[model samples]
Target: PSVQDCTICMERLSAPSGYKGPQPAVKPDLVGKLVKCGHVFHLHCLVAMYNNGNKDGSLQCPTCKTIYGVKTGTQPPGKMEYHIIPHALPGHSDCKTIRIIYNIPPGVQGPEHPNPGKSFTARGFPRHCYLPDSEKGRKVLKLLLVAWDRRLIFAIGTSSTTGESDTVIWNEIHHKTEFGSNLTGHGYPDINYLDNVLAELAAQGITEESLAQEKD
Candidate 1:
C-alpha cells in the first residue's frame, strides 16, 4: 500500500524516525477526509503551522484574500479583533489589490550573499524600483526575504559580488514595495510559496467570512 502523506508539512509517513512525532492510534483514512489544498497533520505539526502563519499576529489565507490575516478588512481601520481566525485570499484573477502586512522591529535584516538584505523591512526603501511590481521587483522582494532571515540590516541592500552596492537598483525595490505605479504583472503562479502560505492561512479560519464579519 502507498504511504499516506501529510499535506501541512509536505511529508510522507514512515516508521518513527530519529525525531519526535506522535504515532497515530488508528490508520488515517484521510484519503476521504482531507480537503483539497489542505493537509492532514499531527497536532504538533498543526501548532507549528499555526505559528508560522501567525507571524504577524493575523491569521489569513496566503492564497485567497490577496493579503490579510485574522484581522482587518471587515473592521474599520482603527479597530482590531483580539483573536486570530482562518483567512483566505479573496479569490480573484487579479490579486494586485492585496497587500501583506510586515512589521519592522528595531533590529532586523535578511540573508547574506551577493545581494544582502534585499527584501528586509517594509520601510526605508525607495519607490521607483518597486513600482510596476514586475518580475524584477519581486525578485528583489524575494532576495530581501532571504536577507531578513539573517537580521543583517547593515549588510542589507543589493550589492554585487564585486563588493559594490547598486544604489539605483536597491532604491527601485524600495519604491516598488512602498509606492509604485499600478503596473500589475503576472509571473508567480497560484501554487507558489505565497499561495502555499495562504493555504495555511485558510486552515486557520481566516476566510472571506472573517473579512465580512470583521467589517461589521
Candidate 2:
C-alpha cells in the first residue's frame, strides 16, 4: 500500500514515529490497519491516541470514526428513570408523555476521566427529560436506551456554559427536557426533535446498523 502521513503526528507512515505527546513508554515503529475499518495508523500514534483518550476500552477510527469496541462514556454515577405519564404535550395531544429523570451526584473522577483524582460537581441533579409517545419517539427512546446502557448520555468534564472545570456535563446528544413550555428551548412542540436525535445517535455510532453488526 502507498504510504501516507500518520494523522496524529503528521509523519510518513514508513518513517519512525515522531509523536511527542503523552504515550506508552515503548513505542513500536509499525503501521497497523484496523481490522474492521481498514484505516491505517502508526502503532505508536494509535497507542498515544488511545492512551490520551477516556480509555473506556473502546477505540474509534480517527479517519472514519468507526468504533471498534463497546463505546463507554465518562458519565459519573447517576440515576436514569423513565415512565409513561398521562399528561399530553403541546404538539402531540393524542399520545402520552414519556418522562425521563436523571440524577447525578458529585464525586471524584475515576480512571476514565481526564483528571482521575479531581473532584467533579454535579450542577444539576435529578434532571427531568421528556419525550413524546409517538412511533418515531418510541424508536428514539429505544436508541436512547442503548446510549444510556453504553454510558453515552452524560460525561464528566468542564461545563461549556459555565466554564467550570471538573463537572458533570451533557454529551453531544441533545435531550428535550421541558414539557409544556418552550421557554427553555428544551420543551414540547418540537416536531423535528425525535428525528434530529436519531440522527445524532447515528453519528455516535449507536444506530440500528451498528446494532445489527454487533449481532452478527
Candidate 3:
C-alpha cells in the first residue's frame, strides 16, 4: 500500500493517528476519504479533529477546507427581513437598494454558547443592512438567506467596540450597516464589496455552487 501523510496529525497514513486525546478502537492504519474533497486521512485523526471542534455534525477538510455537511452556528433565535427600497446607494445609483433587517433579542445562552446559562445582551435590534438591487447583489442576498437559516449571522461574544462580553455580535460575515454613505466603512461605494462578501460567504461554506448542490 502506498504511504501518504495525514495532514491533521502530520503523520504517515500507515501509522496510527497521532491524536493525543481519547482514541477510537479502530485499526491503526484505517483511513477514510472525505466524500466531497476526496482527501484521505486516518479515520482516527478525523475523529479526533471532530471531537476537538464544536461537534456540530459537520466536517471540514483541513487540506482544502471543503465542508462535508451542513455547517450550523450557535446564533440565537432572531428574525431576518429584507425588502426593496426605492432609494439608490451612493455608488450604485443605477439600481434600487435591497435592505436587510436583523432583529435579535436578549436571552439566556444555550448549551452550545460560550457561556451557557448566562444572559446575553443584544445591544442593537432591528439592525438595517443594505445592498444594491443588481444581479450580483441579489446573489449575495440569496446566500445571506442561507447563512441566516444556518444561524451563521450573529453570535454571543465579546464586542470589539464596547469590550463587553456575552453580547450579540456580527459573525465573520460583513454587512453594510450604513445605508447612505461609507462613513463607517461598512457602507457602499466600495467596488470590491460584492466580491469580498462572496469570498467571506465561501469561507463559511455558503456559496451558490454549494446551494445548488444542496438542492440536488
How many clashes does the backbone of model 1 have?
40
User: What is the lDDT of every predicted structure here?
Assistant: 0.32, 0.83, 0.89
- TM-scores, each model vs. reference: 0.28, 0.86, 0.87
- Residue 19 accuracy (lDDT) in model 3: 74
lDDT of 2 by residue, 1-216 (tens): 237887777788888778887657655577889999788878898888888877878888988888887777767777788999998888999999888888888989988787888888898778988888888778887788778877889998778899998888899899987888999788878888888899889767798776565469
Give the alpha carbon lDDT tens digit for every residue of 103-131 in model 1.
33222332322334443322332222211
Off by over 4 Å in 1: 7-14, 17-38, 51-210
Best lDDT among the predictions, by candidate number: 3
TM-score of 2: 0.86
Candidate 3: deviation at residue 9, Å?
2.6
How should the candidates be ordered by TM-score, best one leading? 3, 2, 1
Off by over 4 Å in 2: 1-3, 23-28, 209-216
RMSD of 3: 2.4
Model 3 CA deviation exceeding 4 Å by range? 1-4, 25-29, 209-216
**What residue pairs clash in candidate 3, if any at all?**
none
Q: Which scores better on TM-score, 2 or 3?
A: 3
